[model samples]
Target: MLFGASDSYSADEKMQITVAFTRFGKNLVQRMPRVRFGFVHVVNNDYRHWIMSAIGGSSHPTIISHGNRFRAPRNIAAKEVCKREYATEQEWKNWDWRSEGDLMLNGAIFTQSGDPKAAKKFGGYRMIAYKPAHMVPLLVRWSGTLECRPNKPC
Candidate 1:
C-alpha cells in the first residue's frame, strides 16, 4: 500500500520516492518471483487524489472497473494493460525493469506473461502488458503497505 498526505510533493521528492519504490519492488520481486498482482494502500486523501489524477490522465489507456473486497480509491479500480513489442533504454534508465512504470523485475508474470482473467479477479489490481512500471511515487512522509500475491487463480 502507498501512504502519503494530501499535500503536494516537489519533483525532487517524487523522484526520490520513485527510486525507493523501484528498489523495494525489485527486492520484493527477487524474493517472490511468483508475484503477479500487487496492492497499494493510500492513507492520505491529497496523495490519493494525486495518484488518481495521474493514473486517470496517464497517456496509457486505463480501464475503470468495479471494486470487490479490496478498498480501492473512490470505490473504483483502475488498470492499464498493454503489450511490450520492444524494449527501450529510456524506460529502464533508473532501473532494470522494462518500463518506467513497470515494477516487476523481468516484465513477465510468474516468469512469463500473466492471464487476464487471473488479474481481473483482484480489485484495483493491474496486470499491465509492459510489466508494472511508472507507478506513482510513494511519498516518504506517508505510510502504507505493498501487498503482493502469486500468479495463481484468485
Candidate 2:
C-alpha cells in the first residue's frame, strides 16, 4: 500500500485488480493446481510474474506483474502455479490477464513484503538480497520477449 511514485498505482487500486485477477487465477488453479514453481530476477525485458500463493491451505493465485523474470531450479515443473489473462481494463476496477504457463515456484526463497521495518516492497515481496529466489522489477521495458511471461514452452 506504500507508493513511491505520484502517478504510481495505489494499494486499493492494485487490490481491486487483484480481486478480479484472482478469479482467473483461481480458475487456473482449479483447472490445474498445485505445482512447484521456480523463481527469477527482474530485468527490463521480462514480462509477467505469478505467485503460488499459500492461501486457504492450498496454492491460490496472485498476480505479480509483467516484465519480470524468475530463476528456475533445474528440476522444476512448468504446468503448475501459473495464471490466465482475463480482459484488459482501462478503469480502476477492471483486471485482465491470461495464462503464461505453470510457474516452477519456490516460495520459501522470497520474503513477504509486510515484514516490519523493511524500507521497500516490490510485488508483494521484499528485497533482502542481490540474488533473490524471485525478482520483481518496477516496470516493463521490452516487448515480444517472453523471458518471464509466466509460462515457457518446453
Candidate 3:
C-alpha cells in the first residue's frame, strides 16, 4: 500500500515504485493464495532493503499463500544512494548503515539463477515506508529480527 503524491517524487522515481508494487502483487496472487487482504503506507522517499528481503524470502506458508499482505519492495535495484568515504590512511572500513540509503524495489519474481522463464508476474507491488526519521531506528530493529531468522544450516 505504497503512499505518496506524484509531486513528491520525480517521474523517474515513479517507475521504480511501479515496478516494485507490480512484482509483489503478481507474486502474492500467483504464489501465495492465502492472503485475504493487505495494506501499505508510503511515508516518504526512504527505502528499506533488509525488510524487503525478509518479506521476499519468508518461508511461512501464510506469507507465501496469503493473497494480500504488504511486504517489502520486490524488484529494487540497489544503488549507492548514500555513501561515506574514509580519508587519509588505509581506511579500515568506513561504512555507515544509518547513512547508507538504498531502494529495494519489488522486482520481477524469479527462481534463483536469473532465469526469465522463472519470472513470475505478480503485478505492480506497493510500499508503505517511514520517513528517513522513522527508518533510521527501524532498521536497527529489523536487523535484530533478521539475525534470529537463521540463514545458515542449523
TM-scores of all candidate predictions against the true structure: 0.20, 0.20, 0.17
lDDT of 3 at 36: 14
Off by over 4 Å in 1: 1-29, 32-110, 124-135, 139-154
lDDT of each residue in 82-102, candidate 3, tens digit only: 211222223212211111122
- Per-model RMSD to reference: 17.7, 17.5, 19.5
Residue 121 lDDT (model 2): 34
lDDT of 2: 0.25
TM-score of decoy 3:
0.17
lDDT of 3: 0.24
**Candidate 1: Cα lDDT at 38:** 25
* lDDT scores in order: 0.22, 0.25, 0.24
lDDT of 2 by residue, 16-135 (tens): 122111212222222222211211212222212233422111111232323223332222333223322231223211212122222233331222221232222343443212222133
What residue runs in model 3 are displaced by over 4 Å at the alpha carbon?
A: 1-35, 42-129, 133-138, 145-154
